[model samples]
Target chain A: MTAETLLTWARGSAFDWAIGIFVFGMVLRLIEVLSLGKKPDLAEGRGSGVKGGLKTIVTRSIPRASVFAREPVRITNGYVFHVGFLLVLLFYGPHIEFIENLTGLSWPALPGGIIAGLGMITMASLVLALIFRLRNPVLRHISTVNDYLAWAVTLLPVLTGYLAYSHAVLPYTAMLALHILSIELLLVVAPFTKLTHMFSFALSRWYQGYQAGYRGIES
Target chain B: MSGPSVEKGINFIREQIDAPVASFFSSCVHCGMCAEACLFYTQTGDPRYTPIYKVEPMRRLWENEFTLWGRIKSTLGIAKKVTEEDFAQWEELVYDGCSLCGRCSLVCPVGNDISGMIRKIREGFSAAGYAPEGLIGATTRAITIGSPMGVRLPALKAQIGHVEKETGIEIPLDRAGAEYMVLLSSMEIMNFPEYLQAIARIMRQAGRTWTISSKAFEATNSGIQIGASDLARELVQRVVDAAEELGVQTVISPECGHAYTAIRWEGPNLIGRPFKFKVRHILEVLDEFREQGLIKTRGKEQARLTFHDPCQLVRKGGVVEQPRHLLDLVAENFVEMTDHGAMNWCCGGGGGVSANERADELRLKAFRQKKSQLDEIGVETLVTACANCRITLEEGLEEYEMDIPVVGLTETLAEHLVEEDQEGQG
Candidate 1:
């Protein structure tokens, strides 16, 4: 197909299919998890699980003191890429306009130059994360093919978006189509891979905090 | 196939895959942050000892049985299956390498309860008959002899006889309607008689009525360590039956960390109901006594000292502040360890590691984490609330030829208790 046809397909029918699968898969994934309900703690709780759960939902974003000390590079890299990814996704002018069309909400967008810089940083961080994963003995040992695939799907959007914006290598229409397609790939694979952590991290953090809090210890 | 086999193990894993565990497995990003928090990984520098990786069997089972991708993989015959070999290989990792210290759980950025999952994974290991012989032996003794160390009631009575003669106080036996019923670990009954003496002295001074059931005195649950909840439940029921039979207001778990967790935290769930009587750690009881002015202390230790917070007591039992409060009343120069309280490094002998002879070398190696913590803050004495921690610290210290003495926090408080001239019988 021509670049124009690819761009139209990427932004229209392909995007529609990707969003549908993403939403349905996420809901099904959530059901699979929630349906396996945990037993109520019969032991007398020393503190409130709900309070701890809510607190941990916020607190777990920050690395623990010992872990940060031991693995500062990985933790710092994680923060940079995660924040950069979210900022670029939410604050880019075109992304906001796209979101506004769907959600009927508009927000202030970061400047083009700043978003470009963040996109570059995020892409670099993603590459560094892969290198770190490959080099670190523990990470290398624990990571599976799913981890690598998740990393690729996450990295592609940033890379393609940056390339499309700078009009580098590929034609503008093809590059933009690639950017949208990369995101669609991410959405399709997310619910079935470790990328599911994007949604389940909240549940995981809450449970950990609640368990700790029940014992009157902070996580 | 019906007995402890691979199929049974897989079924147990399926049973254990509740929402929290499911969430935990799903959220793991393989960042390996858990390794930094685990003493086994940090001390041994073994990538295999990474906390999340140790639960590989459970994670695999969850993925294959619970996920859509897993279903597709299974259909394609590409899914990894939990095998007898997997169980055999992982037996050491789950039982020997891990102390169930919960450090990894706390440090996980995604909040995966790595230690909790390890605990669950042990169920599969134990069910598949892949549990170490040492743990199997302990569980058998705990079920058959009412103590993992094979300490019978007669042995406890012998220790009670010694304590009674030494303190000139009657040790209440099977007394009904007592305010508190105290349970003892075999470690305390066999190795640390002074812990019993301290309890007697403290209880007498506090003027609280207490009893040690000839029926169920042992508190430590080998089933918990072995990761068999059914076996754990049987052990817990002994304490429950005795406490309820005596109608004690509270059952005091002795200075053993896992015993406190088994009885105070996991006991109710294991037995399928809330305990009729309250369960309090000995440290919590002593702290309560201190707060109520039921006991008084006139002196503090002269030696520079530090408190080793037992992992189960602080991390799982929530008895953190109570020990610190009790320690404050006895130690003049109490220096906190670098990562004290809930974040304290385990003594590396908990979660049945001390019982499993196969893990001795690795356990000792893991002790370096605790050793370095102590080495960083030089102390003349180490005080801990758990009897198991006391023995483990002593062994680790002896292995290192570090002459610093380890003492029980309860005994330390007992030593400083103001002499009450009118000592009444229990």
Candidate 2:
């Protein structure tokens, strides 16, 4: 097929396929995980476990004072990427337009300048994270091949998106097509990989909190 | 392949792949913060002892058995199966290196209960017959004899005789209508009989009817330390039956750490039903006495002291504030460790680490975390609630040749108990 034809299919059919796979795979993964239900804690609870569970989903994101003291770098850089990614993904105008087309939803976008600045910062934070992982002995020891893969795949779309929007890397159509293709790669790989953590992290925290909260330990 | 075949290990771990385990395996962000929280890792600077890494076998098993990519890797001959060698290496990591102290759990940004997962991983490890010899022998003795340390009825009776003679109070035995059934660790019977005498005196002064049962006097569950739930249930069942048979209103777990957890937290689940009575750590009961004005101390210790929170008693057992409350009662110059209460460092010999004598050197090494905490506070007397913790602390202090004396909270409180009725007639 011609590049024009491929780009059209990539934006149209490929986008539909990516969304379908992303949603269906994520829902199925959740079913597989959630269906393996635990036995009800037959042990008596000392406090409200549900309250602790809900509390952890929020509290876990904010590091404990002691933990932050020890891990200020990871926590600080971690939030940089996370918060930056959220800003770029949800508040960028074109991204919002695409979401509107896909899900029949629209919301006001932040100014282009701010989104671009945050996108660059997020991309740089990911690089620093990668370097931190490689340089730190403990992190290097614990990290798997998938850890590097997760980082690489996550960084690609942000870089390509910024390049495409800036019209600096290649022709607008081609760069945008590559950006979409990288995103499709992310969507396809996500459910099968650790990116499933995006959804699973909250549920896992809830379970963990529920488990410890039974003994009245703060999660 | 040289050791016992791990097919049963595989089966046990396979069954443990629940939602939390699945999510923990999937959602670990590979940040390595858990290493900072782990005593073994921080003290030894060994990355292998990373809390999450200790359970790598289970994680790998989860992947190969449960995940699509893992299945593909297995088909492609890329994934490593959990071998005997894996068990052999991890035996050190799981048993010696970890205290199941829950610090890693508390520190995980993702909220993974790494220690709880380690406890689950041990079910597989022990079932595969790869557990340490010390724990195995203890578990065996726990099943055959009444105590893990092989303390039998005669030994307990002898200790009871000593306490009764020393205190001039008739220690009750198997009274049918006592309000509480007191359980003792073999350590308390063999090494720290002061804990027993303290209870005897305090119960007498509080005017509460309590007794020790010949059948279920042992509280520390070697089965729990050995990671055999079946055997742990049997051991816990003994205490339950003894308490219920005595028709007691409560079962007071003596100054032992895991003993409290094994009974208070894990008791109902082990027996698959609620007990006929409540369970409380002896400190909790004493703190109750303090709160109720039943405990009146005559004097306070002049020596500088700090309380070391036993991992199981405070972190796992929720007996956090009781020891502090009791310390305020008798300690004149009491101070706090840098990390006291729920976040306190382990005495390096919990989760059966002390029982597994093979872990002696590593246990002493992990003691540095506690030692550093003590050094910063520079207290002369270290008080703790758990008998296991007290012994471990004493050993650690002695290893560093530090002059600190490790005392049980019960014994410490008993020393200052207003010298209640010297003639023993309540």
Candidate 3:
């Protein structure tokens, strides 16, 4: 199929299928996870486990003191990439339009040049993070195939989004379609893959904090 | 049975991945901070010793069993299947390499509870019988001989008799309605009888009624160390039944780290019920006495002293501040290690590493991390609450040819106990 026809198909039925699968899978997987239910803590809690859990869900996002001292490069890049990804994903002009269309929610967008710059930086940090993972023997040893795959799938949308907007690579139409398609790929695989950390991170942090918190310790 | 099969091991792993496990697997950001937090990885630089990697087989099993895509990949033979060889190879990493110190759990950016997960995964390893032979022997003895060290009631009675005779203090046994039912680790009984002596002196001063249940004087749970909940529960039940029968208001876990964790924290969950009595570590009870001015030491140690926090006691048991508080009462020159308390380094022998004979070399190697920490502090004496850690610390110190003398915190306190007037003491 010509790029135009393929782009049309990917944006139409493929997007629909991807979104459907993504939503269903996410909800189902979340239900499966959240529903496993904890055994009652019969031991008298020294602290508020719920509060400790809530505290950790927030505190854990910031690296622990020892870790922060040991791993500056990795943690700094992580913060940058996450901030950039959230900004460009939620605040780009056409992205806002898409969100408005999807849910009638509209927001102001950053300027085109700024968004483009942020995307480039975000994508660069991701690439750098990938290289860091590959270069460190400890990281390389512990990493799974899914770790790299998740990183790549995550990077594509920003890269493609930047290209589509800047018209620096393929035709705008093709690049835009590819960006959307990449996002769909991420969405579809996310619930089933390590990307599930996005949702599970808070819950796990809470559970860990609660466990630690019951003993009056912040994890 | 030759002991340990892949199928049974995998089944245990399958049963262990509850919602928290699911959430932990899902939320892992692959940040590798857990590696830095793990002493095994930091000491050996082996990625397999990374805390999360220690639980990899179970994570893979969770994926294959629970996730749709993982199932598809498994059927297509693209995913690696866990095998007997995997468990055999991993036996060292799980038991000898990792101490289940909970440092990884504390530093996990996503709050994964890496050590707690390792503890759960141990259920599978134990089920498969892939655990170290030394731990198996200890667990067997713990159930069959009433103590992992094979000390029976006779040995305990003998030790108590010595303590009573030494101080002319009455050491009560099976005293119904006593305020405290004290428990002892096999290590304390065999290696550190001074602990018994300290407790006798401290309890008399505190004016608290305490007794040792000859029926359940053993405190350390071999099943906890080996990751057998059923066995741990059986072990915990002995103490529970003894304490309940005697109707003690509190049960005291002696100065052994995992004993404190097993009896105080994990006991309720393992036995599927909260104790009718509260569980307090020796340090906690002593600290309380200090606060009440019941424990008055005549003098403090003149030399530099530092505490070695047992991983289970500080990190898992949350008995962090009480140790420092108790130490403050007796150590005029007490110094904190660089990473003391909740984030303290393991003694390289906790979580049953000391029990497993095969782990001795690895345990010594891992002790270098603590050695380095202690060297930096340059303390004259090392004081710790756990008897198991004390023995391990002494062994490690001797192996390194370091001049540091390891002392039990309780005994240290006992040495400084004030000789009160010969009034009606108790």
Candidate 4:
């Protein structure tokens, strides 16, 4: 298909529904974040001076950085899954082209094959993680329904995208439509599920870092 | 691949654990975020010391021997067998690497109680006669003798006589029908005899009618530390029976962490009835005395002090503010450490960590976390409310080459007791 045909498809009913779902999901996520009781003041007694508070945030955060540094292999797998997922979501050829046409802003895109390949890898990693969670009783016991939901939503988009690319028994447009729907579902669920941990993890790490640094101790 | 062996292993595992404890053991996610919370992991940079890794063996057993997926793995020969080597490796990892401080439990996103799991594993080890020799010796002494210190009746009476002679105060022994019964840990009678003297002075200042039983006066319970519920109960029952015989309104626990938990949480459950008399930690008793203006403290000016919250006392007992309030009353220059109150770092000697010789390296490793916190405050002395914490901090300071002195809150208070205030008004 020509670039114009792809652009026209993106601006059609499928994209509009996806956008609506994305907006609604974001609102739901905001509600979830607000509901997690007040952010605890972890720096209550360490020190109170301006410099001390800043130091605490910085020092406490070092533990989190050290965590990633200490276990590079596991962390690298996590990084690839996250970064690759983001690249496909934001910089895929059709998505970027559509965004450029609509917003009058343009960015370079990864080739179709590269985006699809990255998508496949991200999906595979996520599947491996889910399998690990299930196979390990310790993890299985702690996991919530939402954790499984997150894996399913995360995997659905990639699976549908691959199916659309392969043009299986379903029409290519239908497969693309399902893929877009699944992606929208994930975007909406992100803020509500433990997936919102993405935001809280950074905040918690920063708070711990600041407290440790303020106290002039290695976190 | 065989199913019969897997079934046998599953039955063996089930026979070893109670239901509630087993369920809790099966709930870790292995995210290793708990590693960041572990001081041993931080100090030694050892992955095995990470709280998550430390519990992996227990996790594996819970999976392969108890769960369906684990059973499948066992049948396929994919699950590793638990060898004596595995036990030996885990002995060091669980005993020394973890203080059972509950810090990891506090930070767990899923609220997995890693400390509780460690305690349960310790229980398993203890049952299997695999507990550290020192800890087993201590527990054995505590069970056979009246106290873990093994101070017999003659020595205890001599210590009491010495206290009476020094203070010119009557140290009542086995005085039944008293209003309060004071239980002292063996550490106080053996190591810091002044603590017993201070207790007498406080009771006299308040004009309280109290007695100390020669038989059941020891309050230090090793069972709580070793995760031996039966022994912990027996220890607490001794105190309860003595309190009943004395008809006391309250039983005051000495400056010990596990001892307080033994009497407070496990005391009632073990005795199969709720205690009528209130159980109070020494810090709480002092806080009350200070509030009522019963005990006046002086000459704490040179002491720049900070309070280390004992894990059992603060986190488990909810006795945070009382100790700090007492410290504020006594010390002129009271500074709070970064992790004070319920969030305080463990002194690396709790949960029987002090008695476990194999835990030495892990203990020192964990001490670095607390050492760094103390260094940040730069205090002259670290005043804690628990006797175990006092010992742990003293050892930790020496191991870490820190200059800070570790003293109990009551010990510091005893040093500041006003001379005129000691004269009997009652």
lDDT of each: 0.90, 0.86, 0.86, 0.68
Give stretches of model 1 more than 4 Å off.
B1-4, B423-426
Question: How many clashes in each structure?
Answer: 1, 0, 1, 17
Q: State chain A's TM-score for model 4.
A: 0.70
Name the runs in model 4 displaced over 4 angstroms.
Answer: A1-219, B1-27, B64-66, B71-84, B298-300, B418-426
Model 4 chain B scores worst on lDDT over the 10 consecutive residues at B20-29
For B218-257, candidate 2 gives per-residue lDDT tens digits of 9999877878888999999999888888899989988888
Best by lDDT: 1
Per-residue lDDT over B58-130 for candidate 1, one digit per residue giving the tens place of the 0 to 100 score: 9988999898888889999999887878887888899999999999988899888889888988888888888
Q: What is the lDDT of residue B64 in candidate 4?
A: 62
- Please identify model 2 stretches exceeding 4 Å from their true place: A1-4, B1-4, B75-78, B420-422
lDDT of 3 at B358: 92
lDDT of 4 by residue, B53-82 (tens): 666556667656554445777999987766
Worst 10 residues of 2 chain B by lDDT: B417-426
Using Cα atoms, each model's DockQ against the true complex is 0.85, 0.68, 0.71, 0.06
**Whole-model lDDT, model 3:** 0.86
RMSD of 2: 1.7
- lDDT value, residue B85 of candidate 1: 80
